[model samples]
Target: MMTANPYSFRKVALGDLDLLMAWQSSPHVQKWWGAQEPYTAADLADPRVARWIVSYDARPFGFMQDYSVHGWENHHFAHLPKGARGIDQFIGDPDMIGVGHGPAFIRTRLQALFDAGAPVIATDPHPDNAQAIAAYKKLGFEPSGPAQETRWGLILPMLLRP
Candidate 1:
């Protein structure tokens, strides 16, 4: 597991597969979660798909990932060392929505990547998530146009100081 302490970031373990599959199948998360079929245990075990277990306050609250090189969207970050290590996440419990933790989590994650020298950080949400779009802007992400009729909403390439 890879962790940046004060905030714990751990590698996805076999035990996490089921939990991830739960998020993959959630109704609210589904509209924008790529609309792929519900994930099977074997799918979660694939080495090609990277996963990070996002826990907060002693409870699992979210999921983070960088898909396989052969997958969609990741092509935008294929130039990186790992081919796809930008950023993507979903808060598992709907109760956490609009509580302001999202902006903080996103800020921390991007800072962690930046300190590690990541050249860029990116994420795409379904165009309908107005709340998410507003949150990204709060974290300094600006819209960079749409992707395949899907508005990517925001992409934070590199944080530049003004």
Candidate 2:
């Protein structure tokens, strides 16, 4: 079995636009991420979302985003604490897929959020994205309830509280 790899996150910057586009286009990501339209400059500029490049041992290999769940107008998750946050991520490098890095990376993000005073952390993955859901579960996330239909798509709600 692959061991958990040390990882860090760097804020996504202007120079990373092209890289983000490419990763979103990768079939490995596209199949599960299901992003049909490319992300626009405005999307990247959204202040409500925090995006990061996932680096393993100082080498960039994936992407992650965290945002306040209450930031979305009338979001279903607004019932959570005011400090509740949500995260989504993907390993962009095919070579890194199926490795043991994802759970470690997610744990790091969760710790950062909790340290920053987020009382609740949540994630929603497509029901069919078993790999991603399993990763979240490994980190102590529980299926909060049934599937939710949102503009992005149908997502299986998962939650963690610290």
Candidate 3:
């Protein structure tokens, strides 16, 4: 059996912008996530999504965001059942990679979503991101459909049902 997750999550704030930018520039993140402009105050204030900074042992090392699948018009995950949520995340600290933190924290977050009444959780990772695909599989996410190109990029849609 798995032990309890050691990660904690808090909302991303303006002060985290620099850290987020640095992480996005890391080769590991950049390879799979691509470079992203730092989030602005307006972006964080967007009601459609909730962004978070994930920590372990009180040290911040990752970022995550979740949003309503149907919040945006023409969203790739719009076909999911009502009340489904979509999540995107990455481990920022290179030292934290390959230590099982990804799956542990993700499972913790998914449990929270289920406890809050989210019937399904959706994710769309780029088809070439084998590491991410494998982690999601270990967490019980299964391919919901074939790969498709969307505004976000080419993704293999996956979902987990509680």
Q: For this target, which candidate reaches the highest lDDT against the unseen true structure? A: 3
Q: For candidate 2, lDDT tens digit of each residue in 1-162? A: 996647888889878978888988999999978775756668778988999999998989999999988888887687898889999999988899897888988899899999999999989999888988889889999999999898778999999988
Badly placed stretches (over 4 Å) of model 3 are 1-5
> Deviation in angstroms for 50 in model 2?
0.6
C-alpha lDDT of residue 128 in model 2: 84
- As for TM-score, the candidate ahead, 2 or 3, is 3
Q: Which pairs clash in model 1?
A: none
User: How many residue pairs collide in each prediction?
Assistant: 0, 0, 0
TM-score of each: 0.69, 0.91, 0.96
Q: What tens digits encode model 3's per-residue C-alpha lDDT throughout 1-162?
A: 997557899999999999999999999999988879779999999988999999997899999999999999999888878889999999999999999999999999999999999999999999889999999999999998899999888999999999
Question: For model 1, how does the per-residue alpha-carbon lDDT over 9-105 read when each residue is reduced to its tens digit?
Answer: 6777778777877877788777666565555567667776656777776577787775543355545445444433446778877886678767777
Model 2, backbone clash pairs (residues 3+ apart or across chains), number = 0
* Residue 4 shift from truth in candidate 2, angstroms: 13
- lDDT scores in order: 0.62, 0.88, 0.93
Give the poorly placed runs of model 2, Cα more than 4 Å off. 1-5
Cα error, residue 146 of model 1, in Å, equals 4.0
